[model samples]
Target: MHQYQFSLVFFTVLTQWALGSILMISLYRAATGGQELNNSKLTAIALWLICGFGSLCSLAHLGNPLQGYYALRGLGSSWMSREVIVFGGINGLTTLWLLTHLVKGKENLQQTLGLITGVCGLAAITMTGQIYYAVEHQPSWHTPLTHIGFVSTALLLGLATLALVLRQSSKEMPAGFRALLTASVVMVFAVTWQLAQITGLELNGVLVWYRVFASLMVGCGLLVMAKSLNLHSTAMVGLAVLLMVSGEIAGRMGFYGSVLGKMPW
Candidate 1:
């Protein structure tokens, strides 16, 4: 577990969550006929800030932050290089879209920029997954399941966080949507757990406990979110987000804990 990089855990989860939020927010807007939600602009800004912080965390993972530019040199053959490039694009485009929305107030151009930002976000997240999937020696991470898990993490946290933001802002979401979103979170976790089991990766001691606790926390959070939806309790929604975020962080730690480099026989 000593080799597990906490910076990377934060970087991957935070950036993916930010990217996922953009896509989900776009879908939500389309579904609601572009109805503007209260504080939606604030939400977008907060997400971009999160992505920026995550990008910094990624730099912290490097031995020399100044030398980080060299990572782009391997774009032709390195998943890491591609991931970095895509991440930069996502950050730049999203920031530009945010600025246009705040300053120019051009609805049509904002929509165009949003669409482009969302596409780049999706590409960035996929490339993030590929960074691990390309590790041929690490069989545990070489499966398509790695990509699935990354995307799932994005959606699960993205939707939950988005719901929290909307509810807190006193914005109205479509009826029963929160419950549906929470259910999807549960479903994603179940699928991820099943896939991990199928992989038969060994987990001992604290690692096993981490997995169990993370699952429990996430389950509890989803249940709370579902109940809060029915009760229209904003406080409960906030609590659920807290729980889910904590659980996700723990789950990511467990994921890093499970990494098994090629065993030298």
Candidate 2:
């Protein structure tokens, strides 16, 4: 379905924030504590590439790139301003950390940076959700639960995708890959539970979209578990990737479609 341009733009902004935040933390987790996670660096590198490209595209959508420098002016009054700040800071910090890891060949410092990236990345998406959550006039967007929903969707999708991509490169993987799969599936369930609670509140179209999206997310998790149980890690990971895409896309659509007029403003 067609969406208003700005609405599409806003959705993209939040997506970029969510994906970047999830991956940063995951990479750091792989590398830290001397885990010696094969393909962890590759995941980190992919995080930098995909998320960075999305960010650039986001920036390009801006009409006045230089004016973006003044974006934080509304921090006191605008959630968007806060989003810009978190996005800018975490992106910059993550880049430096990722680069340092590459050139310096890893260190405790990189792990520290990873921690920072994860926290900031999650915050950035939280800020994105708040960008709407603060709109007290919009009931659908006004709930604090929206924040949880946004973050959960991001984590589930990001982790599942990263897990899927990594498993593709090699047959063997960290012992935690299965655990990670479990955690991601749990996240999907959490999101689905929340969506059901919000059902019938959104427009019929939006509600239908959310149900479909939410179901697919849940199913993806189940599929992963099934494959994993059958000792089919490769298939499970591949399906997880598909599941993540469905969940993220459906979530963004649900969010946009749920939007309605301001409360008599």
The sequence of per-residue lDDT tens digits that candidate 2 reaches over residues 1-265 is: 3432344444453455445444534563555453444555665676666566656655665679778778778878887777777767877876776775577655566666766677677777777778777777666668776777667666655555555554555434355655665665565566555654664444435544544554354545454555557755667665655555555655565565556422234
All candidates: CA RMSD (Å): 3.2, 4.3
Q: lDDT, candidate 1, residue 140? A: 56
How many residue pairs clash in each candidate at the backbone level?
A: 0, 0
lDDT for residue 249 in candidate 2, whole number 0-100: 59
- Residue pairs in collision within model 1: none
* Candidate 1 C-alpha error for residue 145, in Å: 0.9
Q: Where does candidate 2 stray beyond 4 Å?
A: 1-32, 60-66, 165-219, 226-236, 260-265
Candidate 1 TM-score versus the reference: 0.84
Residues 1-265, model 1: lDDT tens digits: 2545789888988887787777777767767777676676777788889889988899998889998989989988999988887787788988887786678556556656766777677777777878888887665577776777677677766676667767766676565566656665666567457656744445533543454455345444553446555755666765665665556666666566557322342
lDDT for 5 in candidate 2 is 34
Model 1 poorest 10 in a row by lDDT = 203-212
| TM per prediction | 0.84, 0.73
